[model samples]
Target: MALRVRVAPSKVVLQNLITCLILFYFVYYVSLSMCCLILQVYELDVLAPFDFKTNPSWLNTNYKVLLFSTEVTYFVCGLLFALVVEEWVWDYAISVTILHVAITSTVMLEFPLTSHWWAALGAGLISMICGGQTLAYCLFKDNFIYPDLGNF
Candidate 1:
């Protein structure tokens, strides 16, 4: 026996498609960044220790340049998408910015200082809050049905 599925409304389907595309873009962006970091940057670091170096020369130069350019273009395009197309994307972008700040702070602070950790922690906290709001806007009431028992 074959199972049947109910077709969602056109608008709901469109929203789901848009959300999927946004998720796909994020995946691509992250994969590109990781490739650049691991293959192009770390592996090609001439000054790095022998164990740390991979001596990746095959397509590294061109790939790295392309990756950098594409990453920037992707970011700008995502911002434009958020600004002009979807309001929820804007919230996601803001949350992502908070995460970026946290990650940047953590990466920059090499010393074992309490203050540095606190700064990173604060950014992470803000990111979590904003991220929750973004989640609500994107998933809970927007796409799926749920209760609206007062302001969260």
Candidate 2:
């Protein structure tokens, strides 16, 4: 005798939800990075530790760039955790990113005013929503599901 198997629609919905979240963040990651590289300017160190350094404004720009790639990788990791390992990373990592951004803006870079604030706000909202959804899905009482991160 053969046993019959069935799949639920929730699983498909969950997969799409995860993909959308990843895509949303990925786009944000790219935009922020490009803004830094192009809109902002930086200068390499004239003569310090033979290190390339730039102005605070430039540093801000580079930071966006770094965040873009870092976010991409992190999201990818989350994706893998979902797919292969069936895991969700809803820990300090996300909070750390937010905190670091806040801290650096306050302590180091001269924050961009006007439009940038609006942009940041939007980004924050989106992140919160995505993070919240991911958390909700992870903790859902009815079911537990994790995705296999598609491709690298």
Candidate 3:
């Protein structure tokens, strides 16, 4: 007699599970940033309870650039997430380069250009979220929780 193991219902779903989680994290990042920016603009003091001052110099930049760059970054990330797969081609490589340039230029422009702490706060929080997601992915790899895409 030979021992046997049951297989998953769908191989594609299993293969793309990690990618789906990454895409979800990216979506959550954009939504969270928008909410934070809205609250900060109205001076709602959403973070008043904790009053955590995460004033990283790189985040504070010209209001217009901060807003536009963050929005563009979100868009670019969404596009890139859609392109996730086993093999990345030239287009993905180029887009990644562009994203890096956009973020770097805007961050460096913080000192000479105008600065908005609120925008910085929103962007910084998103960065932290991304960092956490990255850490989780690194630690868990394929074992991390992933939803079943077949139901949807």
Best by lDDT: 2
Clashing residue pairs, backbone N/CA/C < 3 A, model 1: none
Error of 3 at 77 (Å): 22
Q: How high a TM-score does candidate 3 get?
A: 0.26
**Candidate 1's error at 79, in angstroms?**
8.6
Per-residue lDDT of candidate 3, residues 23-69 (tens digit): 54465346546655754543323322112233434454323333444
lDDT of 1 at 117: 32
Q: Give, for candidate 1, the lowest lDDT window spanning 10 residues.
A: 46-55
Candidates by TM-score, descending order? 2, 1, 3
Two-way TM-score contest, 1 vs 3, winner: 1
TM-score versus the correct structure, for each prediction:
0.28, 0.29, 0.26
Kindly list the per-residue Cα lDDT of model 2 for residues 29-54, writing each as its tens digit.
45444545565534422121111122
lDDT per residue (tens digit) for residues 1-152 in model 1: 99998777776546644663565346445544566565555433321111112223446553443334334433443444433334445444444444444544565543234443344335533543354445445544555445698997
Per-prediction tally of clashes: 0, 8, 0
lDDT of 3: 0.43
lDDT of each: 0.43, 0.44, 0.43
Candidate 1's TM-score reads: 0.28
